[model samples]
Target: MELDEAIEKRRSIRGYTKDPVPKELIKELMEAARKAPSATNRQSWRFLIVQDDDMKNRLQEGITQHFVANAPLIIVCCLDRHAFTRQLIEKRVEELIDANVMSREVANMLYQRKLPQKVEETGIPVSAYLDLGIAVEHIVLKATSLGLGSCWVRMFDQERVSEILSLPLEITPVVLLPVGYPAENPSMRPRISMEEIILGFI
Candidate 1:
């Protein structure tokens, strides 16, 4: 399917069939996510695919939306906090410099910027969240292109989910994506006019 078609057809699928999503298709979605760009090329996104009934039930306890458990698969999208540490940021910058994608002067300038010195900081960096968001959107669009349906779910207990998944301290769950065959065909949601969305073209 064409990219524009997929974008138009995509919806927040709240209902799904019982049929399981194929493993190959799941791999394809992950591949699309793998190619997404990230801040400083840290590539800090991580995904945990859950399909087991027991695991799904456990996850449902934390998620307010029970429909998520009905899907055959749920992708736990996460961000690796360690990726934002000063050390890793420097490493990624150096790699860009070596590849000629970034100049030594720019790398030096980046080092001068203030960054999280420790990975254990209470608040995750906004850039880390943006990186994960891009990767997750890749998965969402790829799922649509592959004749599957998905929903981006964020109304959940983060700490509870982290415990249920046994995620390490460095890994933080950001979003939950439920994927399967659509059981309901929802009409397109309302949108603001293009003029309203685009303030001004400089």
Candidate 2:
């Protein structure tokens, strides 16, 4: 299917059939997501495929939307704990000194002090969240093109879901996606016109 067709046809599927989605299709969706761009080329997003029924029920228990339990599979998108960002910042700071753009003392000071505070003070950095978003949408749109249905589950309890999945301290769950063969045919919702959406530039 064409990209525009997939975009227009994509809907939030709340109800799903009992048919199982093939693993090959899931892999294709992940491949599409793997191509998503990230800040500093730091791919800080990790995907956890949840097919265990017990774990899915535990996740659904924390959600008010019971329909999520009906999905044959749920994907947990996670954020990296700034390990790579910290390393990148360090490397760039040193490079700045090597290029004579910054003094060694100044680079050391920034690396020793300010850099450590960024990940801690910022807590779940927005840039990482933004990066994860690009990857997540790739999977969603790819699923649409492949004749599968998916719904983004963002309202679930973050801590609870994290515990249910046994995620590490460095990995934080950002969003959940329920996937299956859609049972309901939802109508397209309205969208703001381009004129209202865009402020100035074409």
Candidate 3:
């Protein structure tokens, strides 16, 4: 499907069919997410795909949205807090410089700026959250293009989900994405006018 069509058709699908999503399509979705850009090229996002019935039931306990368990697959989108450490950020910047994607002078300037010295000191930054959101949106759009349905679910217990999935301390779950064949076709949700959204074009 065309990108524009996919964007227009995409919706927060709350209902899904019993049929399972194909593995190949799932891989495509993951590939799209993998290619998403991140701040300073810190590809820090991680995804945990859950399909088992038992595990889905367990996950539903943490998620307030019960419809999430109905989907054939659940993607536990996460952020690797350790990736924000000065060491890792410097490494990524070096790679960018080597690839000529970023100038050495710019990289040096970035290094001079204050950043988290250790992983332990790295709290989840807002940019990291935005990065993960971009990746998740990639997945959602890919799903729509592939004739699948998905929803971005955040109304859930993050700590409980981490415990249920046995996630490492560094891997923090940020969003839950449920994917499958659509059982309901929802109309487009209301949006603010373009004029309202575009405050001023400088």
Candidate 4:
């Protein structure tokens, strides 16, 4: 499908058909997401595709979001804190030096003293969350191209999701995507005009 058509047609769907999404389709979606660019190319994102009824129910129980439990497939997007932190540290190091916050000599000494601690801080998951957001956009667009319906939901309980999924200490869950065939056909919703969206070009 053309990118414009896919973008125009894609909508956040709440209702879904009873038919299950095939595993191969899920694989293709992830493959497309794998190609999305990341900040400093950190690629610190991972996904847990959940189809188990019990697990989905458990997640839904903790989350107040109404639509999350109804879909046939729920994908949990996770951020790898370690990877994002490494990228952030590398990106910021030169900036610190360039700004003259530290001399090269002092920077080198500070790097040796603080780099590890900085890396540790990066594993907090916000970086991974950014990575996951990009990946999720890729997945949603790909799904639209494939005539599948998906909704990016942010209404789940973080602690419950983390415990239910047994997510590692360094990883954080960002968003949940419920995937299936649409049960309702929705007309295009209103959107801001391009003139209203864009600013002066300078």
Clash count, one per candidate: 0, 0, 0, 1
lDDT of 2 at 95: 62
Q: Give the per-residue lDDT digits (tens) of candidate 4, residues 1-202.
A: 9999999999998899989998889999999889987754557778899999888888877678767788999988887666645445555556766776646786466446433344456435355566678899999999988889999888878888899889887777888899999998898878899999899698
Off by over 4 Å in 2: 82-85, 88-114, 117-122
**RMSD of candidate 4 to true structure, Å:** 5.6
> What TM-score does each of the candidates earn?
0.94, 0.82, 0.96, 0.81
Per-residue alpha-carbon lDDT of candidate 1 for residues 1-202, written as tens digits (9 for 90 to 100): 9999999999999999999999999999999999999988999999999999999998888999999988999999998888888998899999999899999988888989887889876357788788889999999999999989999999999999999999998988999999999999999999999999999999
lDDT of 2 by residue, 81-194 (tens): 664556666675666667777787776676565444345433565787888999999999999999999998888888877887788777888888889998999999788899
In TM-score terms, candidate 3 sits at 0.96
Task: Tell me the tens digit of each residue's lDDT in model 3 across 124-180.
Answer: 879888999999999999999999999999999999999999998889999999999
Best by TM-score: 3
TM-score of 1: 0.94
Q: Which pairs of residues collide in candidate 3?
A: none
Give the Å shift of residue 5 in candidate 4: 1.5
Sorted on lDDT, best first, the list reads: 3, 1, 2, 4
Model 4: pairs clashing at backbone N, Cα or C within 3 Å: 81-123
After TM-score superposition, the amount by which residue 71's alpha carbon in candidate 4 deviates from its true location, in angstroms, is 0.7
By TM-score, rank the candidates, best first: 3, 1, 2, 4
Better of 1 and 2 by lDDT: 1
